[model samples]
Target: MVTYLLDIMEYADSDQVIEVLGGAVSTRVIRHPNRSFAFEVTLDLEKGSEHFSTKPPLHFHANQDEFIQATEGKIGLELEGTEYILLPGQDEYCIESWANHRSYPLELERQEGRTVVKFLLSGAKSPEVYELNTLFFENWYKYQEHVVRKGGKIDLIQALSTFDAGGTYVSFPRWVPFGRQVSQLIGIVVGRWLGGLLGYQPFYREWSTDWQLACDKMESSIFQRRWAVRSKPD
Candidate 1:
């Protein structure tokens, strides 16, 4: 594997775009030199054709807290045991630390055009949250192509294991008996040993050429988009 020296100062652009769940996601650092304080991420999705209604797995951030604002369209969020639908221009929905939450688009069939929503994340231990996000997306992006072509599935155990290393725990769905404990144990073992053997690095390595390539791709796309918007007729 080739390695490249990456500048820490330029890790992510304030307007960098990255691919996620077959959608375009743009992330910006809200706080200054210290990103641990807070950061913002926005997802843009097309109506009808894009499947944005599927919710993420039920999970909790042990340290980080998140607030979501919908700029356009509506978003559904499950915080703790209650559900909420945030409309455009409404107040931000806050999810405190340790609260189990899941987010998804609301009423996709009724929505038209495009949808955009932003998330502001912050907490005392927010750095770990950011690291976990980076690791999860890196692994997902790396294997997305292969998984699609082979009609294969993502290894949930492996993903849980990798996230465990960054202090994010994946809770088992209620259907499985004693799944929480069992999955935790398996995650710890695989994350430490098997994941290492397979060369899964949970943390960002600036020296990895893969990291450099991913950053370059995102930045280039953002630059091109900005140039196009500027050159368009008013």
Candidate 2:
């Protein structure tokens, strides 16, 4: 969260390093079918984040659940329709499957003159779960970063493809009744079916560190991958 500038990155072992202006994300993913032993995210927020979103879009996972524990800064967790302020070691928090949620930074808590934010992710998985991997974190953030760095807004079709691949669904406006469920169905049609027909891919090699893993998972699904979707795109 704090700071860096330049589009360069380095990946070693399971940790993928993402550096941006005044921010850095080094992701480490430990995988398993029933649980993810570790998915650590460090958000350093000082300045220079004008192009990025302060919080993720309101979204829910169809089969994945997450736990959050902050060790450095305050995290504002918006869950369902309420926002909860989470402090370091405050308590163990869990975001269940299909729970609409997003996270944002709160006031700086340490003396680093910036928010020293660190988080650990543990997931609840099952045989029915389609996506237990945490590539969603890297893929989503990296895609947004890529778009912003190019001085453009996110492409909706591309976003839909990523969400579908990650087993996530966007939430609709609060005024609409059953908006989340409605939006979920719509996302499947627009982002999954229609988008697939157009050859928009859910995982992109330029944006995904674990591209093959993501591709393999998505390929096992109902939609057949076109050659473009199956191979690395230039």
Candidate 3:
């Protein structure tokens, strides 16, 4: 018997990534619940050519699975008590909640010339997911501030709207790799026109009561709004 899996990224409407705080740590998510058990597949693409580029630090998904595949360039994977350097066409698979690990570029050559794609398979949504999002956004602001303090130009409008989509609610945005500039803009315009025809099936909603309260508080906060407003003239 044979089984087939789809490279769903090809059919996606958005790039499924966040570029502001986390740089190019972008992803596209697909959720499958009608199957035996709920699972999530996220394709993370990272470019090594940019300044201040780095992958997430060492950590593990509490109740999630992960599979790392090197499609265009080489990547390093540490799993099951060992580290492996994966080249193009190679993949490293790991069971969810079984190991603690992370990946990083091994050299400047690979850092500047390689593109690595990591696939994260989760059995179900995990708390670390939200934690990671918060960290990325917070740290990204720090990074932006650092850059500005150092006399680098920063986009305030773009920075304040980091993961926002101009509404009371927000979800993952359609993402496209930086290399695919035209395609990215076109995808966003097309998706807006077609109502997310190629959007992901499984979405992690951030409308929890706490999320709502946080959003409300943020909206009402004078300081936060001032910062966001100040960020807009960039």
**Best model number under TM-score:** 2
Q: Candidate 1: global Cα-lDDT?
A: 0.50
Residues 5-93, candidate 2: write the lDDT tens digits: 11112224755455544465554564434464345567656553443236678888787687776666667789988998776646558
Q: Which one wins by lDDT: 1 or 2?
A: 2
Taking all chains together, the TM-score of candidate 1 against the true structure is 0.60
In Å, residue 113's CA in model 2 sits off its true spot by 4.8
lDDT of 2: 0.65
Greater TM-score among 1 and 2 belongs to: 2
Candidate 1 lDDT, tens digit per residue, 1-234? Answer: 211111122444443344444554554534334333344556666522333445667776555565566655667788765888766656656677656677776654544654565554333335342233443444544454346547787666456544654445565666778655665566556764465455444433431224443333223332212211222222
Q: Which residue runs of candidate 1 sit more than 4 Å off their true CA positions?
A: 1-14, 21-23, 28-40, 47-53, 110-146, 173-186, 197-199, 203-234
* Model 2, TM vs. native: 0.79
Ranking by TM-score: 2, 1, 3
lDDT of each: 0.50, 0.65, 0.36
Clashing pairs in 2: 1-43, 1-44, 1-45, 2-22, 2-44, 2-45, 3-22, 3-23, 4-22
Q: State the displacement of the C-alpha of residue 174, model 3, in Å, after optimal TM-score superposition.
A: 40
